[model samples]
Target: MPTASSVIEIPVPADQVWQLVGGFNSLPDWLPLITKSEPGEGGRVRHLTTADGGVIVERLQTFDNVARTYSYTIEQSPFPVSAYLATLQVEALTESSAKVTWSGVFTPAAGTEDAAVEALFAGVYNGGLEALRANFPA
Candidate 1:
């Protein structure tokens, strides 16, 4: 499995950050690339439309409000990954600071294995984290 991770420090309480993104289908609220998010099948499935007219479908695997963590698996996507699993976790670093880590592991799609980590996982995770950080403003 190829794994990619991205971390960003936010100058806000962990609870506050989690409140913004804790919901399994809340990607549209914070993810810069997500244009809209639609829920399906009792909120377990999410259909996301990106700004660039791309669509992705994902399923919520685990969501722990007390732990401030959530995990999801991609069911359909344009990225070069199969069997992809991603987790978003928020940890307190201080009374007013927190770190958010977004990570995922996947089996690259066929011949795209070589660049999947950089082009898909890292690009999406890091870019999204950076956008979140920008929104919070350290």
Candidate 2:
């Protein structure tokens, strides 16, 4: 499996960051790439509309509000990967700082190079984290 991960440190309380990101359907609140998120399957599935009019469907695999983390799998997406399992987590670096990490493991889609897919997700994760950090400007 190919894996990619990105972590960002934000000068915001972990709880505060979690309040914005912890929900399975909250991506649109902080991620500019996601224009809207609609909950389905009793809140376990999310149908996301991208800023560019693309659609991605993801399902909540695990959730831990107390831990400020959630893991999800892509049910449908334009990204070139399969078995895409990703986790987003927030941890306290200090009372006023947070360490947020997003990581994923996946199998490259047919005809897709491993390096290409890995770099693709790494870019997505890194870009998404940067956008997230912007919400809590230092």
Candidate 3:
């Protein structure tokens, strides 16, 4: 399995950021890769496009309000991978700022290139965090 994590400090209050990221349905507004995320425990996330212009779907595994986190597993991926799990966590650093961490682990399918997969994951994770920072600049 390969894992990647990134954090960003946003000037927005923790509640503000949480309000945006806490809801799974808001992903399409901020995430460039995700086309839409339906609101439900077992809802599906539709990808806009794959590296090869294909589509992908992921199943929601957990969305914990108390923990301020959401996770999903790739059920229909265009990539050659399996057991994909991604999560997002939010923590308040101050009244006017907060830290958001996004992380995930996945196993590339047999014969798939690990480096390429890791790079792709890192790019998407970090890019998403950057997008959030831009949306809620500190």
Residue 133 miss distance in model 2 (angstroms):
0.7
Q: Is candidate 2 or candidate 3 better by lDDT?
A: 2
Estimated TM-score for each candidate: 0.94, 0.97, 0.84
User: What is the C-alpha lDDT profile of model 1 across 5-90, one tens digit per residue?
Assistant: 99989999999999888888788888989989999999989999999999999999998999999899999988877889999999
Candidate 2 residue 131 C-alpha distance from true site, Å? 0.7
Regarding TM-score, does 1 or 2 come out ahead? Answer: 2
Candidate 3 segments exceeding 4 Å error = 38-53
Q: Rate the local accuracy (lDDT) of all candidates.
A: 0.88, 0.95, 0.77
Candidate numbers, best lDDT first, in rank order: 2, 1, 3
Q: Which candidate is the best by TM-score?
A: 2
Residue 104 local lDDT, model 3:
84
Give the range of the ten consecutive residues with the poorest summed lDDT in model 1.
112-121
Off by over 4 Å in 1: none
Backbone clash tally (model 3)? 0
Cα misplacement distance, residue 73 of candidate 2 (Å): 0.3
